[model samples]
Target: MPSLINDQLPPVRHYEAAPLTKEQLDYVDLPTIDISSFTASADPNVRSQLVAQVRSAIAKYGFFYVLNHGLSTAQTVRMFDIADVPFSDVDDDEKKKYQSRLKETGTQQGYKPRQYHHIDNGIRDQIEIYSLNHDVNKSGHPAALRPLLPEIEQFAYHNHVNVLYPILRLVELHKWEDMSESSGHTDIGSLTLLYSQPIAALQIRTKDGSWKWVKHIENAIVVNAGDAIEFLSGGLYSATIHRVVQPPADQRAYTRLGLFYFVLATEDVKLKPLNSPILQRRADIWLKERFQGAEVPTMAEWRKGRTKSDGNAELKASATNLGVEEEYLNGVLIKHYV
Candidate 1:
């Protein structure tokens, strides 16, 4: 099969700003947690309260805003500055020099230019992305970014140990116009930490099935649970369904830059429900609805299948929308009916 990369790039298209719908105009904020106490306090009671708050947020919304995460505003600015070099400063030819053959590597690391179609809209989005996988330090990143690696790595490690527990290091530099961005979809990993650059283009699907804009809060990082965690939690926690859209008319000229850290479990971890008291109480009903009587696949097996499907356009297009295939290749439930 031909690779997903484009040999010929298309002209960038622009969209006119439209008025926000009633649902979009109103703001429904995500749960916000102050994690400083959780990390600082030695008392078990304080720690337990924090844990319960996190569990409640995940069980209901699958996403939250985190404050006091140790990284300062200046540190975040520096990281964004480093991220801007490749897309904004470097010439197109220089950027292409780092382009990756994702089909061959079976990974999303390295440079990917615009024209990648959105699954929901089927329109080519105007965006550029540079991905750094677990071996980013060993990988051939541009020399200009080397100085910032230590800080970035430290932040990733801290979040992994404190929140994700088991993680696969994958960071992405995403630069895109507010006019064209990602469609609503759940991430494949266990968790995702997104550092936004004061642009408010991100939105999350609410319980009422309406789209609500997620406002950009200063010094706060947006974190969301993914499919893997949802699977492990046995329907108690859901993976958030979200999308990046065009900013409102007033901010149309501003480009959106996001630093994304995707967290994955160890390869050997099974995609089965954890034996927690909360899950155990409803395991029979949840398991029946989740698996639909099919056996679950290991994390490694599921990742392989997911990457394979993503790389092949035809295969991805034909696959079942709700993940009910011949096998449970995707880590999430393969339900026949919602």
Candidate 2:
């Protein structure tokens, strides 16, 4: 038996196991779209067909990989590698400045980063992030983005405006999650851009009702949906069930320096199917469509356990006011079925 004397026993601690190796990473070859197809197609019909397909995927899978987009190959690689630089290598004061300011001003949401729980069950996903909001009125002018990360700031701007906006018509990038793998809850947004290094830990809710791995592709951008799309389609779409499971015990993983850009439908806009009128007109099929198979939990269901934490009380970010509130209509969300 171990004695109470401090000297009798050595200090020990528990550390997370290693991350999944390349062979072990989930290799997901999801559908990819060639952006040029929409732009270069002289044939109007082909462009329509492609856009229709991409839109359908967003509505249904809530996740997809895009290719042949405007981003350059060299730029992509650099984006992945830049975050790997040692902030300690920089003027120590630079990192200290970041830490001090973040601690003082709260998070990009005007709240402290320490107050909230990633999940209700005492999980600590300690990440600190800032936001870059672009003012739409200023055409040439960009948003106040990436002041600390100036290296990627230009890339973010050009992508958001030139490439992404024309295609997705997204207005502004919401507060980026200053986090790494460790999924606790989901949220309601139109779209998300999962920008990460070669971190092989993108896990998602599999179609089989099990959470499986999403193979991480270095320098590739992945997009997914949120509750807003689900609500608008009346659940015809998927908000996706994704999380960052730390690399398993043996494969210690690299620290994931990733950004999740929650894309919103320009505020005040309503999301509906192009065929919304047609779908709404057919109530029975709509009902059938919404309740296709095994039901997943709602935002409220997944969020049942979340509450505030104490370590960072100064940055208490409250949940959005019951955002994306709606009923699935004969869906599994209801209880006491008559």
Computed on alpha carbons, the lDDT of every model, listed in order, comes to: 0.61, 0.45
Error of 1 at 297 (Å): 2.6
lDDT of 1 by residue, 181-287 (tens): 11566776777888745556777888877778777777777889887787777777887888777777666766677777776655666667777687788877877
**Which candidate's TM-score is highest?**
1
Over the stretch 100-183, how does candidate 2's per-residue lDDT look in tens digits? 233333223211233333332465665544333333221121112222244444555554554454346323322222111114
Task: Judge candidate 2 at residue 137 and give its lDDT.
Answer: 23
Question: Against the true structure, what is each candidate's TM-score?
Answer: 0.76, 0.60
RMSD of each: 10.1, 13.9
Question: Which run of 10 residues does model 2 get worst, by summed lDDT?
Answer: 173-182
